[model samples]
Target: MIPVELWPIASSLKGELLQMQRPQERFAFIIDCFKTYLSWE
Candidate 1:
């Protein structure tokens, strides 16, 4: 399971991504968020 603190922030960001206009923009946001999460590991 994901840690409590990180899960909510990640989830919120992912939800926010739905508002993005284009697929490329959403993909970039997801990629950036994934990188940020990996950096924390």
Candidate 2:
């Protein structure tokens, strides 16, 4: 289960992914976002 604090970030990522046209770009974005988020914690 996702922690409550992460809900905003997850929602924003979903929004960005929906706006993206290419599958590769979406995949890369997810990877990059997770990397950044993990680094913060």
Candidate 3:
């Protein structure tokens, strides 16, 4: 699931650009990877 904090930004999107199915899975996967990288501090 997408983070609640990201809901506002995601919800602001409109039209077919935001209509791609299952994009959230990709977005969340990316975020998880990014978090892993950042947490290496």
Candidate 4:
């Protein structure tokens, strides 16, 4: 599952790109990975 705070930003950045407008786009967007890294680890 994906994180909460990152969902919006990821979707937003995904929205910004043409090929990233899909649900699985986050798979390609490093924002998700970055968010995970910046989280309380």
Put down candidate 1 lDDT per residue, 1-41, tens digits, no spaces.
77797788878887899789899999988899789879978
Which candidate's lDDT is highest? 2
Question: What's the distance in Å from true for residue 4, model 2?
Answer: 0.7
Q: Kindly report which residue stretches of model 3 are placed more than 4 angstroms away from their true locations once superposed.
A: 1-21
What C-alpha lDDT values do all the predictions have? Answer: 0.84, 0.91, 0.63, 0.68
Clashing pairs in model 2?
none
For residue 23, give model 2's deviation from the true position in Å: 0.6
* lDDT of candidate 2 at residue 23, scale 0 to 100: 96
Top-down lDDT ranking: 2, 1, 4, 3
**TM per candidate:** 0.71, 0.75, 0.45, 0.37
TM-score sort, best first: 2, 1, 3, 4
Give the lDDT of residue 11 in candidate 3. Answer: 61
Q: Please report, as a residue range, the 10-residue window in candidate 4 with the lowest summed lDDT.
A: 14-23
Q: Please give the lDDT score at residue 32 for candidate 2.
A: 95
Q: Give candidate 3's error at residue 26 in angstroms.
A: 0.2
Question: Which of 1 and 3 is the better model by TM-score?
Answer: 1
Q: Give the per-residue lDDT digits (tens) of candidate 2, residues 1-41.
A: 77999899789889989999999999999899889979988
Cα error, candidate 1, residue 15 (Å):
2.6
TM-score of 4: 0.37
* Model 3 Cα shift for residue 12 (angstroms): 32
